[model samples]
Target: MFTGLSAFPLTPVSGNAGIDEKAYGRLVHRLATTSVDSIGALGSTGSYAYLTREERARVARLAVEHADGVPVIVGIGALRTRHVLEAAEDAQNAGAAGVLLAPVSYQPLTDDDVFGLFEEVSAHLSVPLVIYDNPGTTHFTFTDELYTRLAHLPNVASVKIPGVPADPEAARARIEHLRRLLPATVTIGVSGDATAAKGLNAGCDAWYSVIGGTFPEPALALTRAAQAGQPERAERDSQRLQPLWDLFAQHGGSLRVVAAAAAHLGLTTPRNLPLPLRGLGAKEHAQVAAVIEKLQLHA
Candidate 1:
């Protein structure tokens, strides 16, 4: 399958900050109409860490239901391997196409911990497995060696490597070498977007994206262009998305930024960030609104 934009949407929050199926379905519908190859719910973009088990499963079902045909990759990240295994089973029961796992949590883990974690989870699961790399928070990266190890695991289907823009060309070369470690059936992934096209062109099989959560059309268009070797066109669209990038850059790894984008397009209901991490304040929201308007996105 062609690796294209995979919009990892935020789970909607209702009036009391509960899971909002209505809002989530609406957002999913909008994305489903785009060229997104897949949809991910309860992933980092969906604030999976903040949700209860029931809420995560509910969002997983909602995402698949609304996607209609687009595969739903549910986020099954947790602090323990057993919990992740259980969540993966839950996602499978909930009809998710696959499971996306972020390595460990809270405390930093050694490379051996990562190997054992993936090995354990992959052993228990029947579905395709995806590795989520969010070094901005994990503070621990999947080293070339670590990834090499996980890539050999049976159920490992893909790797989601994000924020390597510092030297994307070099990252691509590195990923290409790493791809050698994985099975041929396994495809590599990047957190797709305009700026991400470089790595995609270099060798990504897919893009698991937060930006695609709101701008699937534009983002997918760019990814398609890049895949076709149309670097000039892809660069143009990536440049067009700079403002949105600026917003997330300011947040510095806050997954809440996905919700902010949803609000920007008026696709989500009145949503608030759960405890600990606050959403953009009043003035910030207004400024974000101004930028979204200038870009002429939905809403």
Candidate 2:
């Protein structure tokens, strides 16, 4: 479940309405039909932080149901350890193959605090747990020492690190260093879609992707190429999507651009993000459409 492309699908919610289960199921089913190794139901890209517990549980169940036989890894992050435990229980009940936990908090969390959270959660989880080190959203940076500590916890299967360095050798060195620190039982997955190919080439075990949630084909193509030791093909496939990566940088991050792309493809309703968040405007949508067309992403 931790290896290859773990596609994190958006949890589409219309304005002043509940989750669009039909649309969400469509996204999960689409991924299951593809070569994605796992379905990441409610990661950062899925807007798990914004939904209620009931809503999140429903989304987890939906993801598992729609995923066919593909493994489903559900995000179970919350502000409090109690709530995180509750979310973990809900995900387990929903038959999630694994749970992804990010240390989310309003107040800054110390390494001990973060480790305690994982320790408590890991003790309770029957399935594997992926340590989500998404500092971009959680605002808690994890050190190699912290990773070593957390990796020692039982049921902790993988660590989703941030992007690797742009330079190839530097990226490989970074990954190699982490590999030595982490137990062989624990895998190191890479986030940051733009650098996924490089990370894989650097020997990272998986791509915890944002764009893969919406466009599995290209992401899977890159993943398969990399895993097959065809680094040149993987890099070329990644370079081909540079325009979309630029769009992610132009916008705040991947969440908005991917939502816009999904809407453009008619895979989900326009403005499908949760309340207090809005989709791209007309001009930006036009740009997304152009990029999708040019890349032949929908073909």
Cα lDDT of all candidates, in order?
A: 0.76, 0.95
- Give per-residue CA lDDT, model 1, range 254-274, as digits (tens): 365666667766787546456
Candidate 2: worst-modelled 10 consecutive residues by lDDT: 271-280
lDDT of 2: 0.95
Top candidate (lDDT): 2
lDDT of 1 at 170: 83
- Candidate 1 positional error at 245, Å: 1.2
Best by TM-score: 2
Q: Which stretches of candidate 2 lie over 4 Å from their true place?
A: none
